[model samples]
Target: MLKIKKKFGIDELVNLTSILAILFLAAAVVLPHVRAFRYFALIPWLRGIGLGGLFVFLILQAWIHRKKVSELFGHRRARSGANSALQIVLFLGLLVVLNSIAAGHRGRLDLTSGRDFSLAEQTKKIVKNLKTDVLVTSYFKETNPSSMRARELWKEYSYLSPRLKYRQVDPDKDRARAIQAGVKRYGVSVIEAEGRKVEIEGTSEGEFTGGIIKATRGEQKVVLFLEGHGEASPNSQDQENGGGLSTAKEAIEKQNYRVEPLSLIAHPQVPASASLLVVAGPKKALLKEEVSAIASFVERGGKVLLLLSPQVKTGLEQWLKSYGITPDDNLVLDYKQHYFVDASAPLINRYPFHSITQNLPDSFFPAARSLSADRKMPEGVSAAPLLETSDSSWGETNLLSRNLEYNEGQDKKGPLTLAYAVDVEKKEKRQKTRLVLFGNARFASDGAFTAVGNGDLFLASLNWLAEDEDLIAIPPKPPGPQPLVFSNGQMMQVFYAVMSLPAFLLFFGGLVWWKRRRS
Candidate 1:
């Protein structure tokens, strides 16, 4: 008893206090929300006491072991050990800084073959450019696949814009909130903005994003497709026959635009509320009255989209010339840019930076005609090329030739313009008139609308004409099958790997401490 009392002196007492202080500090951090600690209000005091006690104990221990401590560090190997300790501290600090930054920016890469977890381009644009606060509340059952899925999507949406706020609640536990949000069942997402609310039932990209659009964009604009001259029908659902513009219409409507067919023979004039006038490959020629009415529509500061084909006349060529746009009678042939063995189906990868073609990918126009703008434009009218052929393509005037090569003088040189955008400002009326002329109407037809960038081009052009360029980007794609399942063997392997690693690290650390103490 006397020997033990002698060994457990003030030095041992101080050492025990220091260790207790460290354990208390760790408990304060790890058990921050413990009811007992909070009731006693020891969290803040615990940290301060731990720090003070550690400082005092360190000072006393250094004084008691002053000679031994000095001798320990005097050796070159001991100094190297001190340097290694400093490097470890610095590395830990760097890791803390990185984790802090990562917490601020919640981002992750979605590595899936179908990009199943990624937000659509159009959705990204809308959220990033949010003008007002949007709150998206998700109602999904806990442990449901949809709950996890919506959370992953909300993480991305929240990262995009600070204005977009997301909240997830278990439908069963939060029944009161769910009922208030009109979420009768799970998988409903309520989006509220500007005193308006929209509910989305499922994870459909179209519905989810379309709700945001409606909440942001209040009033919808009308897009009128001219029909009397046998224009391509926007209501056509026949993808097999390539008869309808159904795909094109669906894309346009997704941007919150209303599409309807207009006939000059029935209505005799464009509606005053018509936001855009589309003439999609008018097979028959327009009557003189119809042509006059179309001109009047353009003069009244309305937008017009003309999709013409080679050698096809809508009787608007002379009228188009007045606006510095002429649909050339020659066929456009791109030997360099066209698809395999089909020189006429030119794959246009190049684009000028206009709102219509900004970020637009490669688009193909099948059996397209060439268009030209006069070197000097009409007064107050500006012309810009939206789509063009490569320098290897030319305008072949001899449409009768089946087997063809470029003719030097008889045919126009390569790099002919296939599409032109004309902007006319009527200063007297304080109104602006926009025109988007494409030499090929087939590009916007049903079968071809799904081609790469083809649908984006059509939708973008309409948005530009309507002066709603905010709604332009690649539209969202429907979610695909996403299943993450593991077998028993894989689960066991993962479990053991996760469990064994920390145990191994802790064991290794203890062994190192024991060896150092023994030394």
Candidate 2:
């Protein structure tokens, strides 16, 4: 051992120990950033052990060969110190230049679990193909956290294209500008392009991208709602009792749609410029002339949406029968307690392969009925189901009973349809008339519109009725909160390694020295 030590001098040993110390220190600094370290419980302990071993090696090398190290580097210590200081100054200057260059050019590494800070694919597709400049104005208060997040989000869009730019205006400071721009609340985003503008109150990637699509469209679609039959009123602000559809109207308007209340009693026929007509939850039966006008509209290849509540005697049942759709007069009850909030609200997650219901989230309909559609079709008419209840659900026949149970012959079995879409071919015209029927109108009421995915479902149905299936239902993704988790055993391991190792080392060394002195 002495001969080997002579061959490999103290200088070589010191160099080797210094390299090991640097490697261990680098591992200790870099391991926490790794994704695998979060799942692997032993990585932190290993890092701590490496750091402790490096500290021990450094102290032992310094103490054993203190004279040799002093002779090697201390003779010209002033010159060495001067060179090190100059090198550190040069390194700092280089780092500053690099930082300035990096600041001017935008480059982001979205390390979040959901990539929440990055732009979505749908947003990139719209921004990258911009032919005109899009000016996005944000109305926010500088003191709010939403203002900071909105600024961060708009930067992602701006980085994608030069034609896209954003400006932030504090609503409190600039009250006139806010009123002029029609800013209703904080964090409202107004997107303008080609002399058109859209105001969106949501900050999701999908909402902003949808606003861009609406502002840049060539033409707007019009959706007319029928009134005067004791149906749900659009002008009413009362949310409960299913008296208002204001939230549904706002959702449709966000897609560049023009929504207006129409009455067939005043007009002889449906308006020629109408793209889609809606009959929402009529409480009274339609008169003969009004029914004839609606029939004429459908006969001439028009699109229509009908929402009927349970047990309402809307006299158009026979006409719907001709199209092979039957709106049942029973209540839908689901025994799946986990899927519904109560027995009245049936949750639906299953859907057919249709453009309207594709990729839709789970929807909950409170006090809804069911529809019936057979495999047999009418001549040149095609019909399909949109939403259906689970196998644990059934239609209750006796509404008067306190404890509702399915009767063998009277009540219907599971998997009942709640909505249906029907398409009819016109013999003389090139266009097809489309009809969508939902058994529940309360789903779109202002009070229950945002219950679950009910808002997206409502918008998607409107898009299908207006023949704008391309923009069915694109919703935003929000980031979820992440919590810190550690087990008691893991915490104990960490404490022993970080707090106890050095104390143990000192005690062991002291015991050895005391024994040697006694000998």
Candidate 3:
């Protein structure tokens, strides 16, 4: 060993130094860049380790073998050149082993600033609890932007569960497959499970997750929206003024619930098949008979969701008081936690461990009213607050005032209740009553439904009301314009890296060729 080492001399030491550089590069590529170390970032340190090893090793080799290197390539076919082949083969074998180990793990780390690539907690829950095989088929051009993005997302999904499979095809290339699947256009994803299929467009997490939910749903429940009191139409998609419940309706339907607008005037009684009743933002007063019919529905162990806007005389307010949920006649105003430029839209971030609000983020209620849950409740009735304003919020009595300020004595101060969940049960053969009350319906309207947490809030409320706690997962995250923009300095660094790699290899190749030609 010593003889061999002495014969090779500095060249052997230089080869050992190259091993260090390769190890550093391999580590940098394999490990995830989750955080920057206190001393330095992972990539930069790895780069420094590799380049520094090469530099120091080269210096030592130059000093030791100065006499030998001085004669560039005059030697004819030196026997020493054959030794590199064995080392090269061994190096390549090491790389194959490292990459195989990495491939076996089948996991990836998201490095986006907003973590947009990361799946929501709800999506994980849905995928992990899958009971059957699911296939996601996409009809799109391979090079299309949406197809590429969907494929990237599917890489994570494929790792999440073995039950979820994905396949993509270029519609132009596979016209027969596209036609068989009933897909007429591109950019469509069909999630199929248990003989059911949900077709969707777009590549947002919310859109894909929603399709999974529908495809995997077991039973179809019914949600009836009360009409005829100027309530927001379930079919209206107008988002200009925020008076449409269409988005909310779609969200409910995604959870395997069939949503239908019910006109009490046409059929005075709540149907027996209704899983829940939604009275969403009624502007005009409900007729006496209509209000009576809703009361009858609640009395018979039915679930009800009542969402209200401020300054409206909803006749059910007094009726609701009898059941322990009271409506305050004021607009909730929050100066601290609110949407951008609007204090009227109180933003709620934290929540108690209730099933509805447990998995939600910062949500805002626009032009909302206040609801007071009765401390002294009726027998077999209990209420819990679902949504609340910030500490600096207030309930304004004079909503019509041109310039509004919190009245010290007249107005209510800070952390007012915006919504409540009421549970009712009795020791009888009849079913128990469940109720969810909200201060504002516009939170679920088309204008605000896709807000960070607005749509989830609506869906969670429905889940609780329908007694499907398992379905109370978080809604799809609302994606924003998060285009990756590189700085000029960063771009220049990347450019140098891109150019230097091939340049180094070409120079080495030229040196090798010059020596061989002399042979």
lDDT of each: 0.80, 0.76, 0.80
Q: What tens-digit string does per-residue lDDT give for candidate 2 at 317-424?
A: 888888888899888987662222366678788888788887676677778889987568777788888998888788887999877887878998888899998988
What TM-score does prediction 2 earn?
A: 0.63
Ranking, TM-score, top scorer first: 1, 3, 2
Q: Runs in model 3 with CA error above 4 Å?
A: 1-98, 141-146, 169-188, 237-240, 398-409, 478-519
By lDDT: ranked, best first? 1, 3, 2
Q: lDDT per residue, candidate 3, 45-144, as tens digits?
A: 6755765676677688778877776564345554355457558956875775565455545555889745666787778888878888888898889879
Candidate 3 C-alpha error for residue 34, in Å = 34
In model 2, where do residues sit more than 4 Å from their true spots? 1-133, 137-147, 158-190, 197-211, 337-341, 427-431, 476-519
Lowest summed lDDT across 10 adjacent residues in model 2 is found at 481-490
Better of 2 and 3 by TM-score: 3
Quote each prediction's TM-score.
0.74, 0.63, 0.69
- Clashing residue pair totals per candidate (backbone < 3 A): 0, 0, 0
